[model samples]
Structures are given as C-alpha cells and as structure tokens.
Target: MTTLTPAFFAQFDQDRLTAADQAHYMHGYHVFDEHREQGALNIAAAEGAYIYDTAGNRYLDAVGGMWCTNIGLGREEMAQAIADQVRQLAYSNPFSDMANVTAIELCEKLASLAPGDLDHVFLTTGGSTAVDTAYRLIQFYQNSRGKPAKKHVIARHGAYHGSTYLTMSIGNKAADRAPEFDFLRDKIHHVSCPHPYRAPEGMSEADFLDFLVAEFEDKILSLGAERVAAFFAEPIMGSGGVIIPPRGYHKRMWEVCQLHDVLYVSDEVVTSFGRLGKFFASEELFGVQPDIITTAKGLTSGYLPLGACIFSERIWQVIGEPGKGRCFTHGFTYSGHPVSCASALKNIEIIERENLLAHVEDVGAYLEQRLQTLAGLPLVGDVRCQRLMACVEFVADKRSKALFPEALNIGEKIHRRAQAKGLLVRPIVHLNVMSPALTITHAQVDEIVETLRSCILETAAELQRSGQYAGH
Candidate 1:
C-alpha cells in the first residue's frame, strides 16, 4: 500500500486539481492518462444553456450535459428543492413495501404524464440501472407468465441503452464494448440499424423503412418469438450517434412485437422530459405504445441522478397481481432516493410551468432549419434532426458519404476546435451532435451552428494540410 500525505489528499480536492493531479486521480470514458495530463477543462459554474470553466471561459453547452439538463443548469428552484429534501429526508429504503413521500409523489406524477397504460413506476439511480431493472423485470414477467425460456432480448444495431452489463449487452455500439467486454451474455441479439443516412445505395426512404421493418420481423422469427422476451429501443438513438429512425419505423416494430407477444421497451433515457418536446417520445412522437419505458438523465435535469422504468397496465396486471407470492428480487439501494425524487419533481414542475415542451417544439424547428445551413460545408455528409436532438455526420466525400480514416480522429479534432471556440458538441465517431436542452434559444442555436461551421472548416483545413482530405 502507498502512504498518503495530507498534501497528497489535498491535491485531489476539486479546488486544487492540477494537470498532474487529474492525471493521477481521474480517468474518463475512452480517455487516456496522457490526455488527462494535458489538463481538463474544469467547469466551475453553469446557468441556462452555458457553462463556465474554472479558467473563466464560458461555453455554450451544445450537448446539454450529456443530453440530460433538459431544463438547463443553475435553477434555483431545483437547488432549493434538493436542499429542502436533504434537510427533511435525505435517504430512504424503498424495499419491503417501504416508500418515501417524495418518491411516491414523483412516481404518481410520472405515471400521469406517461402514455397509454404505462402508469407503474420503478425508480432507480440513473439510466443504466433503469435499463438493467427493465431487463430483469422482463425476465420476471416472462417467468411469471410461464415462459421461462423467453430470455432472449432483441436490440437494433447502433442503439445505445446504457452501460451496465445487461444494457451493454443489449446495446450494439461496437466501440463501446470491446476487448475488456468481449464475453458479454449471449442472450441479446442485434438487428440492423435504421439509419436513413447510411441506407443502401439505391434504396428510397420508403424502401429503407420497409427493409428495416422486415429485418426486425425476420430477427424475431429467427429467434423464435416465444423465446424472445423483449425488444429494447431508444426513441432516437442517443450515444449511438443520435440515429433517427425513418418515419413509421417504430410503429412497425411495435406491431411486430405485438404480433409475436414480445414486449416492446422504449428506452427514452435521453429523449424524455422535453428533450423531444414530450414527456415520453414513444407514443407521442413515434406513435407506438411500449409495454415498458425506461427513462433517466432528463428526469431531474442533471440536478440529481434518477431513473424510472414505467410498466404498462397490460404487463403490470400479471406481475403486480396480489398473492402471487412473487418478489421482484432486484432493486438498487438508491432506487427511490429521496433527494433525487424531490429534484425530479421540481424539474418536472419547471418544465410544465414554463411550457418548455412547446418552446422546444418551436425552437427545435428553427434549430433544424439553421442546422441545414451546415450542409453547404464539404465535410458535412448529413444533417439530421428530431426536435432539439440532432447530429451532423462528417465524411471525406459528401457525394459518396465515405467516412474519414478512423486513425485521423476527425470527430475529436472538430470537437476540440469547437471547444476552443467556446462551444461543446458530442463527437460520436465521425462527428454527431445532440443539443437536447429545452432552454436553448434560437439565438443560441445560431451561435452553436456558427461555431460548428468554423470548427468544421478548421478541421477540414487541418486535414487538407495533412494530405488526409481526398478531393471527391
């Protein structure tokens, strides 16, 4: 064991975090120690759609704090709600029929806001747990209905559910799961991704939609519908490059699920809570009533971690039946954490009181229109948007839509350029952006687009200088 001095512990403090200290103590997703040694931008404060680093540099948070922060940051109401809850009841055990008032209230509110018969809620700490819990519940439901062999899960390629073992197995992001996670459970199957931008060469949008639907049905048939437990999907794929499925794609998938008796699970972790101008995007935006909906991130607007798996009455009727002598046998210690629930309650109130959903709907259209302007850039292969969530795919050839060499790290280059220009956008492989906060205004949208344009131009120039840009 290494001996630690008081000074060494002090170095780990946020206020005293230095480049060396960060390299020693902190590591983030897909980041190496060398990158951390170069130093990280320490955010000291945030308000509305912007965040200020410790260096006093203000940045327009284009990704909305990992697509959470739906109502934006630095809300006094959210802070007060959390503080008040902490003082009154900071923790509670949600097991054994025990519950907290705030948790109950949040559940009730969520149930009322959810679509169709999805009125039952099981709270968790965040998106991953919500997804894990849903997967477990699906198994339990299957077993309860005398179908224990129905243990297989079907997910789409390029879908991002979460990070837990089960969720990661369900997700099809090859980069997210690699060398270390090579032994994932074999119960999950991945179908073709329904991305219009990368559709087959000669396939029309309608033909692509039909192809995707047929692929889903064929996968179900291959797995033997009775052996497949559920189909997991994100309303609009978040971390898997914000992939937006073609119109009516979700409805067709849901129909396949219904015909096969396989449960349809909507993983709306990023799209819920006004991100897509709706409480839940499954039924409202996609015209599909999922048997279960998993949500997090925006639930508390990143003020606190909270997630929920809402069950439809159709399934709840079987699983929640009285005297069944069945226990869920799964729950997180912080499943119904009081402070998180309180924060979520306040967050929901703010979204409703301010009519932020409508605001997102109006501004989202303008944002999409503004984003279309980026299509004029040579590097921009595709510009796709659904409400406030959008993505810009960069390619070496706009006509051929060929991706840049992976070694070039072109997406990271543009991300760094944008960050230096006081803007933050997510880099999903070959450049993809998601600005989900409802607080982003049309003016901010213009700023984001302009910053992206400059960053793309700078990246292209650098690529050209390096002889990496092949003229189409």
Candidate 2:
C-alpha cells in the first residue's frame, strides 16, 4: 500500500507555542514545558508507518504511536466504518438494559476471536479503565462466591498496568504512579519480574523463573492468598521497559494462581490484536487461560478508544448472570460506544483478511535479525523481541551489564537524536522499545535500524567526548 503525503508543510514557531501549551496542557509521560521548551515536533499528519511534521519532515514511526496503531495509518476502511456508525447511531449508553447494534455485534465478534472460554466482554473507554474494570470484576466474582476477603491484587515489579488509582496500584513502575494518597493505602502487592538480563550474576533462566515464582508464592502467602483477588501481568512487559520474562515464568505463575484459586488477569493491552502475532498474547506466548483478560490499544488500532475485560464463561456466569438489581456494577458512559465498536470490528477484519498475523511473524523475524546487529554496540547491554515488540537496553559496560546513570539520560538523548534524524522511536527509561505497525515492510525496518544505529553511535561519541562513557 502506498503511504499518504501531506499537501504542504506546516509552519509554526515553537517559542510562541510554548507559552500557551505550558499554561494549558498537561502532557503524559513527558516533563511538559521542560521537554516542550526544547521543542515539540508538531505532527502534521500520519499515514502507514510514517508521520509528517509541521516542518515537512517525514519520519519512520518505529514505535507505532505509543505501540498501538498495529494496522498502520490511513486505513480508510476503519475510518469510514466509524463514520458510518456515527451517522447510524452516534451515541448510546450501554447502561443497565441498553445497548447499540454495533456494540452487540462487536461483542459477538470478539467472543468468536478470543481464545478458550473468554467469550464474554465488558467494554470500557480504554486500557486503564479495562484494567480497573478487571479488578472490580475479580472482586465481584469473589464476593458472588461468598469470599469477601479477596480484595487485594498481586502484580509484578517492572510491570505497567495503567495510571488510574486502582490500576496505578497494580502497576509496578513507581514513576508512573504518583505518591499514594490516603485512599490508596493497602490496595496492591508486587512481586519481582523475571528478566534474566537483570537477574543476579550466574543465574540461569530456570533459576530466575524459580526465584520469581518463589517470591510470588511468598508474597501471596504473606498477604494471605484468601485475601488476594487476582494476579495481573502483561504477556511481555510493555511500558515498564519491555521486560520479557524467562521461559516457563508465566507457566509457573499460572500454576501458582491456580493452586491458590486466584483469578488470573492477563493485561493484553499492548500485545493483543495481532500485535504479538496472535489474537491474544497470553495464550499464544505462555499458554495461559486467564479467568479475565484486560485489553485495549490495538482493539481499534488507534482509530477509536476501546477496551474490554474479557471473562471466561465461569467468570461471566458469576458477573453477567441475570438477576434483579444484580450485574457487574461497573460500566462507562462510553462503554461499548457504537463508533468505537464499529471501528474495532473493521480493524479486526482488516487484520484477518490481510493475514497480518502471518505478516507480523515474517516482518517481526526480519526486525529481530536486523536488531541483533545492535547487540555488539558499546552501549548495548541486551536486545529483546517476541514478535512485533522489540527493545534494546543500553548500558555503560556490556561486560558488567552496568547501566548508564539515570543522570546521563542516554535513552532520552538517543530518542531525541533519532527524532532529529526523522525517526520516531520510544525510549523507555534505559531501553528503546519498537512496536512498528504489523504491516510495516522490510524497507521500513531497514530505515528504522539504520536511523537507530546512527543515533546510538552519535550518542556514544558525545558521551565519550564528555567523559561520560565510563568504560571497562
């Protein structure tokens, strides 16, 4: 498919823009004016895996718009589907006894596509809400079964669930969560994540997995497993530095959850809908049949905000059973919004019809092979990938695997340099995570790798020149 081109370049000066933006806008994942003051590269438009800036600069979108837009941009079919739905029934509340046609149809489609007994869905506005809703569902399910003490949620360190109060507790990235308010006390517990690269020296993958599982078991026991509601995890940690767990990690965790009879909540928010070469990442990668699944991001491929907490029949029977004044006791005004549903229906169709999963497997393999070239670089410590998702961790000493000090901001500098060179990739703390559109071509991968190579080299040179590249 041919990518789109803008008619003309946008011309806007940043000095004048910062005053107003700083006064009004609150940016997420950014230091706001401190970063904006340096410059905000205004994106004029986007199509396929490329975005054009106000200055007419064209860049490869390596991160796929925060790792969401899986099908790429300029998808007329999805946009038109949304438009059609809006015209047909733009707004509707799925509260209590109400629902639109699109919502109903999308639910059926999702049920057919989801794995195992995950046939029922509770829709939400986006990923965070879906996560929040899952927590509520787990609690509600336990209550229905006459267990009121199962209110605590167990998550893992280095996991990024969401930013909502409940989800922030489940999320492990301390930086993502604000200082706890009085209301947030005693809400969540965390276990060590299984990242062999960050594991203790001489620890094998099996040892790491065993250690994490033991830690999880200890935490659950200490917290009183009867008081624990669910265990939340991403198939491969996304925003939390893209830390992929060792093999058999999830298998062991799933066994532990089963042993304790705790609900297993897999956060497929960043890995669902062909993003990981499957409809769901947990089943495809780890053989997990979660009691509930929290997902968003690729559901509508960024065309519209949509998320869902998919429950197994057992969970649905507990939550969705018909009774007077008895339901999940949760929903959003925009839950199962007609337009969003239509967009998702169309997006999923595109993914299947185009065989995007197979494409992801192919292009994803290409991406991994190309990325391995980066492993030997002076600043590279480890490279990770499981399909469309990939990341490179930077360290000051590869032999010792010692990270560059946070003060150096090596990752952010590399990100900025890549942006200057017309490449858009995300730097998560000390790693660069790339989640390009599943439809990206081989040429696009080459462009991304070449740009990244240049940026790393330049950043290394600058640091060395400044005496910051503390060597072996």
Candidate 3:
C-alpha cells in the first residue's frame, strides 16, 4: 500500500529480508523458524577476523563462521583465484576417464602435504561426501580382499563426522541424526569418548586409554572382528564440544585396530588443512597415521566446497582393482569441480608460502595459555582446548565439577552478550567454543579474550537477576 520510493525500498528490502529469509530457508543445524523468530544476524560483509551485519554493526568472528572460514573472510587472493578459474573453466566432471588439471594438481599437492603415503585422492563436494566415500572405500577394500563379512565400523563417542545417514550414524553425537534416518545404526558401533572431563574420576590417563582400548576390543569381539571394517575418529573432536582425548589414547587404539586387522580412518574434516597447527591433526597430535583420512573445510579455506578421501597404498591398491566393473562405483557429479580445486590449490599455497601452520603452532600455544586463565573464574569449570580451537565449560561449582542445567542457557547468554560487545561466539550446552582463523594476531587474541571476559561478567549478573544463574 506504500509508495515505492528508493529510500523506502532500501529500508523495506533490509527489513523484509528477515521475514523472507525466515519463510523460505530452513537453515542447517539451526532450529529454523524458531531461530528465525529471534531474528537472524544477516552478515553483509567480512574481512580478516571481522564481519559486519546488514545493520552495519561489526563483530570479531571467533567461531570462524561454523568453524569453516579458517583463512578468515574475504581474502583477495582466494577471491581472485576463484574468479580466474571461473573464467577459464568453472565446471568439470571428473568421471568416466575425464579429469580437470586443477583437480589433478590439487590431488598431487595434497598427497605431498598429507602425512605418510596418503598418495591417492578421491575428491568430493564436502565433508559428508568425503566421509561417505571413505566408508564406501573401506567396504570396497574389504570386499576385494574377500572379507565379505567385514561390514561394521567403529566410531568414537562425542565425534561429529557428517550429517549424511551413514556418517551421522557413526558420529558420536546421536542428536545430529534425524529420527527417521536410523538405518545405519546396526552397521556402526560407538566406543567411549576420550574426553577427560566426562572421564570417570580416579582414572589415570593410562587407565583411560586401557579402558577405551578394552571397550573397542570388546565391541569388535562381540560383533566378531572379521565383521569390523574400520575404526573412525577425529584427531580432536570438534562439534562434540572440542574434546581432545588423552595422550597415547589413539596410539593404543590404533594398535588394537591393527591387531584386529581393522583399517583406521581419521575424519580430519575440521582438524586438517593446518587449522590445528598442523597439516593433519591425527599424525601431528596423536602420532597415529590413518590408512584413510577424510578432509575438508580448510582444504579450500571454505572459498569453494572441496573435500577428499586420501588413502594409503594398502587401501588404495585393494580398491583399485581393474576391469570387470570392479570400480568403487561411487562418485558425485561435481566431484572435482575445476573452480573448487583451483581455490583449494591456491589456499594451500597461501598456507605453505605464508607459513601459516607454524604460526598456528606458536599462536595456538599462546592462546591455550591465555584461555586457561578463565578456569579460575567462579562460573568456569574447565577450559578444554588445543591449538586455535578451544572451549570453556561452565559449571555450577568449579570444585564439584557440576554443569549448569540446560535450562539455564549459560552458554547462550555468554554468546549473545559477547556478540553484543562486538565479539562472536557459539554456545553448545554449557560451553563457549572459539575457533578463530589461524591468521589472527596476538593483539586480536588478547582482544577476543578480553571481550569474552567482559561477556561472562555481564551474563552472570543478567542470569543471576533473572534467577537463571544455577551457581549455588
């Protein structure tokens, strides 16, 4: 009913975005309409470690946009690389003997960078596809080797592999899976999470590792080791609230897997591509080389969607059978998109040329040290972190190690408060997770920590007055 003036249209367009986006889009990992009702924080632009909303308000992005924007938002080099590729050849189907030069080069570069002889690469669109490919590859290898009964896979508790039915089924977090898509439940079994906070009291690191290994052995034995295909894990669990397992836990677990002749696959989707102060978190952190590694996110630095399932010669040779329709019989239409591969190659070049991995090692240590100071706070129970990724768990009583009830929404309060103060944070359960870009400066680290500290005080008072502070 209103006249369509230019100024009016601008404001109307901005205001109408909230309603329009809410009505059509069913956002991922979000409660959709419910969160939409709360008003989405629509990002307009971003650069370095900061993002500006449509309202022109700027915020320091600590969570790195679902933990994917590792190289930070809006890098000119990445943008140009994507543009150049789009001009030359934007799309290609790497199927039926057809391939793209960018894709081939990316595979070679990734092979050179990957730990050990993870020489072969099977590219995919994203993390879920990479995980699914790895699963299929495992099956293919086992079947080729005449282990027809080897169908079950072992996944660690509190891990997030992907959202696809198979990956979701094996993921440690059961809540991520849709209620109806529980078909793969029987094919996957979960082992104890290596997180120390959830670890039972009076258990040493040695005992914990032994307990987990024993559980893995028990589960495999119960299912018959011959039926077990592979053991899947994240070097450090990400969406499972940033849990870092005990030292040597993976080594011992790998030993058990080897004893059972089970293949090991590391889901380095979030932990690879130098995000964890190393090219691969599994080999760098746990000192265990996986037979297969699924990686994404930083592969293209989220500039373009690209993921890969890299495998050692053992698994590769078994699956690379010739003729008679012996192929793996799995692939996506956009499996090796030229543009995505171009972006990934350039991104990796930036990481290597800039020495970003070594920077993460130094800055990550500094961050861990600084972040640990939050532990002494009355509301903070423990700070679990390693190298650029961190989480602060809120407890009702630090001494007793009791968490605040979910109803309190302490993490949400802290997150919102931090966002208001120009710092972005994500809340999961009773913890605040920060996964800032690896390129963050020391000053930026200090600023992030300072803002978070202020947010805690502000949230505490607000929650206390509202009778939501669960601290007794």
CA lDDT of every candidate: 0.86, 0.84, 0.84
Best by lDDT: 1
Write model 2 residue lDDT over 1-472, tens digit each, in one string: 2333444542455455656666666667567545655645667678888887766688899899978989998877777887888889999979988889999999898888788999998999999999988888887888887888888888888888887877876787855654534225585888887788989999888888888999998988998988988899998999887788988888889999999988889999999998888998787779888888888999999988999989999987775567635656678889999999999999999998999999998999899899999888779889988778899999999888888877777788999999888888887668888999999999999998888999998888888889999644
Model with the higher lDDT, candidate 2 or 3: 2
Report the C-alpha lDDT of model 1 over 1-472, residue by residue, as the tens digit.
1223444334344546664556465544746644554667767668788887655568899889988988888877777889999999999899987999999999999999999889899999999999998998998899888899999998988888888777887898867867766536688888899899899999999999999889889988988987998999998988888789888999999999999998999999998998889988989889999999999999999988899999989888888789988888898899999999999999999999999999998999999899999998968888988888999989999888988888777788899888999999988779768765798888899999899999888888877888889655
Summing lDDT over every window of 10 consecutive residues in candidate 1, give the lowest-scoring window: 1-10
lDDT of 3 by residue, 1-472 (tens): 2232444334535677887778776777777545766967887667888887766678998898777787877887788888999999988878878999999998998899888989999999999999999998888888898988998998987779988877887786744654655556678888888888877888887787788889889999999998999999988888888988877888888898989998889999989877788888788678898999999988887777889999998776676656636766789999989999998888888888899999999988888988887777668878987888899988777667887777777788788888888999888878899888889988988988888888877777776788766554
**Model 3 TM-score, 2 decimals:** 0.95
Cα lDDT of model 1 overall? 0.86
Q: Which residues of candidate 1, in runs, are more than 4 Å off?
A: 1-16, 20-24, 33-37
Each candidate's TM vs. the true structure? Answer: 0.95, 0.95, 0.95
